[model samples]
Target: MRNAMWMQGVEWLAAAASDPQACKREWERGAGTVLLEAGRHWDVVSVPRQLGLLALDILWYDPLRTPGPTLVDSAAHRVGFFVPPDPAGNWAGADIRRASKGSWVAVPPPYRSAGSVEWIVPPDGSGTLHPPLTLELALRQANKTLAVLAPVSAD
Candidate 1:
């Protein structure tokens, strides 16, 4: 049941990546950073060229989803969610942790951490634009979309 719901999140994330105008801004310091907003979530996809790495930060708001206690902060409880990575590579290769926390009763934090979603893609805009029906495929395609959206440089 949880996995099915997660697929919904993937679909939503992909739709956000498909929009050309969804890009809101570029970071002054980050070379390949781009901000994307769609629906109720804000995603920051970053490509650090120097490090040859790509990362995505998605802030989702859904009062209907409740994360497990060990997945988030102790104070966080209720409808909010903070998904930890899956060590078994079930979700994407990364897993959620003890420090991760969320609360439906309160607002989520304003910061992103290593625990956030991570993936890789080519710099060219050669990714599948349509939303993937599965989580793993969605992660791959979303990373590809990020690669296309990420700035080549500070220019």
Candidate 2:
């Protein structure tokens, strides 16, 4: 049941990647060194570029089926890959403690950044790129989309 929901998330992520305009703004805001977009089930940590590898598992997704799938509501659980401000760290803020907490499911910190990455086409959520898309660029896109979901985001 959870995997089914995750598959839906992958579809939504791919649709978002398909939109240059939406993804562009999202890219710039995330300060992502790279942005990779694929189907919704993708996790940034899985990327070769992601610091420790910020893998996000889509616990749930609600789609509307237009311009491709989009996430109406979703849940994700995150695993720590890197520590922030460490350059090698993919984390957003502060440090990981013995007892970390969040409003959503467990994962890495969502950040507000000011750089951008672009994708030529959408991948199906393999966390790897295809055709015009590249792995380096995909990481940047992931950060942007993840940023959009930040608790204080305008997106």
Candidate 3:
């Protein structure tokens, strides 16, 4: 039952695709990933991998907050977090990238984790997205933590 619930959540996410049936078919046929438009049901916020990891940790540890789906692209050294749309458009940071209305994001199947991109935190099937304010705060804290842990040296 638990596994079924997880798949249901994945299906909910796939429904965001332009062609939901086609998207599911791709995953069924062993496609590594599928492209989905952003800003309809949700938006994506991508950040440097290092900062993202830190932010993820911080979010997870917080008792009052629960982060939504999160993805990581190992090759690109970036991480993407799913959040509610439009409101996060103005979020700014040193290396943060927001995928809103016109942007397309490549999403791997819920079972795929060996490719260049994989989910660090998959969707829970509850349509729960990261609260923008909470996410911003976590990212800010992560940025500060990263700066202190690995200060750049001047040549």
Candidate 4:
């Protein structure tokens, strides 16, 4: 279930990347622009780590398609981070061995946390968009994505 959320996020991000403008932007910059939104934005923060940091904005929304990923066209909106790379350094991409570590964040008045943490890893040696972003983090990451995204269990 949780994995499905993240997986849908990825798929949505990928679809957005298909836009030449967004694709070129991702190629040029480590962090690309995505259209992830919830019905309302709960809060926003940075998921930090050594490798890098990414922004995760809690949206007042849930993935449109779960148990299978599909972005909700009507979710709220907030900017989330995906990595902690230099805003000045060469943006991360294919052939980049260095993987970024991610943290989990909770939004709003929730005393504790809600979502999960992750390490976003690109494919082993490919980033041409020919291959999807591959995660080399924990089985948890894969499992989470699988649960939310739905394709992981297909095989």
Give residue 76's lDDT in candidate 1 (0 to 100): 23
For model 2, where is the 10-residue window of minimal lDDT?
65-74
Report residue 19 deviation for candidate 2 (angstroms): 48
Tens digit of per-residue lDDT, candidate 1, span 1-155: 54554444334333333352332222122233233332233212112221111222221122442212111222221111222221123332223111111211111112221123222211111212212122234345545766688789975
Residue 144 error, candidate 3, Å: 1.0
lDDT of 4 by residue, 1-155 (tens): 54554344333334322253553344345332333222221111221231112111111122541111111111232222322222223333322222222322212111111223222322111112110122123222423444575455464
Question: What CA RMSD would you report for each candidate?
Answer: 17.7, 18.0, 1.7, 18.1
Per-candidate TM-score against the hidden true structure = 0.21, 0.18, 0.92, 0.17
Write model 3 residue lDDT over 18-105, tens digit each, in one string: 8888888888787588889999988999999999999899999978766799999999999999998886434787979899999999
- The total number of steric clashes, by the backbone 3 Å criterion, in model 2 comes to 22
Model 4 TM-score relative to the real fold? 0.17
What C-alpha lDDT, on a 0 to 100 scale, does residue 110 get in candidate 4? 10
The prediction achieving the highest TM-score against the true structure is 3
| lDDT of candidate 2 over 50-121, digit per residue (tens) | 211322222112142112111111112222221111123332332221111211112210222122222212
**What is the lDDT for 144 in model 3?**
85
Candidate 3 yields a Cα-based lDDT of: 0.85
User: For residue 136, what is the lDDT in candidate 1?
Assistant: 31
Sort order, lDDT high to low: 3, 2, 1, 4
**Candidate order by TM-score, highest to lowest?**
3, 1, 2, 4
